[model samples]
Target: MAKSEDFPGKPRNAPTWMSGVGRAPAELPEPNLRVSVKEMLAQQQVNEPAAKQAVADTKVENSQAKVSGKVLETQAPNGVIAEISTTNIRVSPFQPRLSFNETAIEDLANSIASVGLAKPITIRPIGDGIYELVGGERRWRAHKLLGRETITSYVREMDDALAQILALTDNEGQEALTEYERGKSYAKILDSGGERSIRALGRRLGVNHSIVSRCLLLMDLSNEVKAILDTNPGLIGGKRAKDFIEFSNEEPELLLQAVTAMRDEQWTQEHALRWLAKEIASRDQQKTPSKFTDKEISGIGKVRVDGKKVELRCEKTVDAKRLAEHFEAFLKTIDRSLIISE
Candidate 1:
């Protein structure tokens, strides 16, 4: 069963459909086989009236239809769980998952094929006969994978911000979700104004502040690196993302090269890190500057001397004739022979 604190701002009486939080699916009650003579008489007396009342109740329920458009609906505690057409159900734009594991989804499809869907997906009616998924996307995909036309869904009411929060919370800590993807979701939640700050967001999500802070560091990555993550999020782990971000700032070009190699050559993060280290070390070893001497002459600006060549940068107000005469006398004092042809 879901506790109110599980969803910080959720209504007290609302049904909890979020993954791993809600009450167990209700079970059908066993039928009473034995009948008493007096009980049978009493049941017969009320059956007619009960039938009439049920008809009236259904009319009211239909008037205030639980979900828009036509869907086979079953009532739950506070909402309706329906068998909705898979085509009409769309993934939420606020969904945090960037990629899905096909093999895992196939395994799920096989399991569902064997035992049926254990839990229905949660969604919200988005009008025009469309519904937006809130959780259980894997199940939805499995259903699609099986070519099932309709899927069991629990339809509820929630806005984009709440949907995002629920989506993030539902997928957090799952084995398939990469830390880079998690960090990206965190950035979206923060950008959406769902939380005022990282601490507040962590408190709301029941996540540790340090973990959240470390994850947020991935957002500082360059756009190119982020694009790489968009396709291959598992390239770097959350713990490594912090170190990677540092390297990206300190050695941007090298980081890009390493990440590009990871994408193209299918290099592991460990391999990429090792390659980056070797390249940086090799670069440092190969860097050696040419020997030259620079001196600032009092009123004649600066002079630079290399083995056989000397350059004089004259001051703004120095007379050209005076500068030439000064260099002529200065050249005569040199111990080595001067090349004066030019």
Candidate 2:
């Protein structure tokens, strides 16, 4: 029993086991932690006031250990800190963030390896020995990277909705999650029957209603556009995504072409807008008749050429077979293989 006296920066009121146990081993290759429950119990020399009482009152049942007068249970009262096995924790199904930055996770792992975890992850007991992550996935991942068997966690009692909200709030504050991801999170909650309306959902999550509405709007984007956004989350913002959705409604085929070009060509929003404008103008220009010629032929009723289309109104008495023969002969003069008929 090293007692709280041996651990530097130990909280005066904390039990001996909780104080110095937070530090990770100096070397990654070593399986030993700075302090292990078995090693601490081996000494049997508790000295601190709280540590003495905690050990005296300790109890064990169903493979659950009681230390500091607290039990790690699924129905335990909220706000308990415990050292738990990493293998027993499960990722939350409500995780809104789809992508994690590997470089950032690596940096975090290196930092934790150099200096022990500064903050404990938040989790809620879900079963006999299983816990579901509420927040701090990055920290959990870092602990995994260090090959640690256990992690320090702040345990809580929360329902699915609360757990999901906390997870979103945690990541939103820590990193730059794209607006699309944020919106997707909002949509999930709404779809889960958690909130009645965007306004209510925003109020519950403490986000602006407009922002929530914008995020939901992304759900309406074409699958093609959504696929692009999935891989490149920062491709277009909520406002721009709305623009795309609206443009797609007007000209889906043309918009898909432009969106594909936007991704491949690395186009700026302004460039894409300009390209769309030019293309629309060119199409409209083509529709306008730029050339027209009308003349009365001696044998034929009349001849007219409008842009690329030509029409002839044969006189009522004109021979239909003769006119067809003449037209076929005229087309042959232009190309020997030319033929007319359906």
Candidate 3:
């Protein structure tokens, strides 16, 4: 067996898997990965001491108690890497991440094909010969690309709360996860029987408390807005998301308008924010009646609203027969708010 290695990066609870693996050998036409599973395992087993020494040499003084506890669980008391069938592992259902960059994953698959997996994914045994992933989904995915039957992993007993914490902390470290994704994770953690408060969640995420709060608001974003954000990530962040959400509250149509502008105009975050703010302002401006609004009635004269009531003024040239028609037209222009409030 090869010397065991840890996962390449931190943990995230996002969803991703390899697509090309399901293809038949004829589709590949030739070998993809350079080494056989047996050879790779042997190489890892042979390099164990060097890997451990490297870890020891790089180790720094650590005082964070929470980190220490989690770290202890990641590696067993004897510190040996274990292997199990890939069929036994199940993706975590509570994962907060919904999207993954396809290009990045493909590159990882290519790397694994050339050399082999550098790090083992973390998993906790659930039952019935199954395990749930705690971290290193991408690595698991790369292994899937190799079409291997077994995966190298750190196996341990973990509760839902600790699994969640490990997944969030690991994910937040590696990529620019959408604010919506991160927020959804925070909401899930909160939903996990109060294991983490907003402040505690923020501390774990290494973000401000307000940032955590803003991410939660993402859950309230209209589906249209979220779909747009999903395809165009840098298009919105927590702060910009708050702007779109505020506009949505004013009038749901206003949020839709922002989505349309963002899609059709290909707006930058600044452009979208500015447009939403201005549109909301314009709609707000048109809402309240000023001192008076005049609607001309052509032949009959004009109707004026002096805020409280409608006043009809007639010109000497107008006939009285058209009076009802003009009055009906003026009714459409009347403020419905006062009537509704009553």
Candidate 4:
């Protein structure tokens, strides 16, 4: 028999009956219940430390990603102060940005050098320690030309639309835009949520509505005409260019030819338009009948009838009696005719 102390909750003889004669009824081993619970808790503890370490590392990396650079300390370089020499820096190919006269740039450069940059350029970081110019490219250029290294600038984080506007403002203020440049800039403004009408853009730029409309038309000209204008900006004024727009698309080749002729021969706008008209007429002649015709009369002279009017033009050598007789016969055939002129 097992003693009560040997089996804490069982009767002394119960162990023996249940199992064999108890030599302490084969004691069951204690189940390892804490093992799984302790393991799960331990794993959670381990993950907590790892998560904390990861957060710390991420913060440190973020801090290290900030932008860093200093402005150049020297005066602007000479070439940089002048107009942008690259033709590829167009605002829009179809509608170029306006251009300012050289005289204006020179004046502004002199002012800037004397008094320092009145307005700072705006730039935004593009990555890899480089910054894309947002605005004040002209000022930046001038400073570079003045042998300057460090320039006064406004560093901005901007979206595409704002960046374009800043760039345009800077270009416009610095007198770096051409008429075409002005037109394109106006177009950008029109497209960028400010206003869509040419008149509105003209108002913003302080120009007439007609001028703005003309510039818009110029946006549609072929590259050839644009090239000529770009080469010699003063070749034609806004008014002439406006008139040229009327013919640019319909007669591109002829328009270009006229522009070339005008440039080479220094022809006036009137002469160029007239020459273009004549060329157009000649081309039309090839496709259709003659616009004017002459008819000969027997025993008389040739007369011209231009659809609306009939006249007899004779050389001095013609006989007056024969001409008079033919005229009388012609009038008789017509029955009743009015001759008011002598």
Tell me each candidate's TM-score: 0.65, 0.62, 0.58, 0.51
Higher-ranked by lDDT: 3 or 4: 3
Ranked by TM-score, the better of candidates 1 and 3 is 1
Q: In model 1, which residue pairs have backbone atoms overlapping below 3 Å?
A: none
Better of 1 and 4 by lDDT: 1
Candidate 2 lDDT over 113-212, as tens digits, reads 9987887788877767688898988989889988988787767767888887888888877777787788778888888888888999888878899988
lDDT of each: 0.77, 0.74, 0.68, 0.58
lDDT of 2 at 172: 70
lDDT score, candidate 3, position 21: 44
**Global CA lDDT computed for model 2:** 0.74
Residue-level lDDT of model 1, residues 189-238, one tens digit each, is: 88989888999989888989888888778879899898988888888885
Assess the local accuracy of residue 240 in candidate 1 as a C-alpha lDDT between 0 and 100.
68
lDDT of 4 by residue, 244-312 (tens): 777886899999998898779898778888998898989988999766778887555678877677777
Worst 10 residues of 4 by lDDT: 73-82
Clashing pairs in 2: none
The global Cα lDDT (0 to 1) of model 4 is 0.58
Candidates ranked, most accurate by TM-score first: 1, 2, 3, 4
Best by lDDT: 1
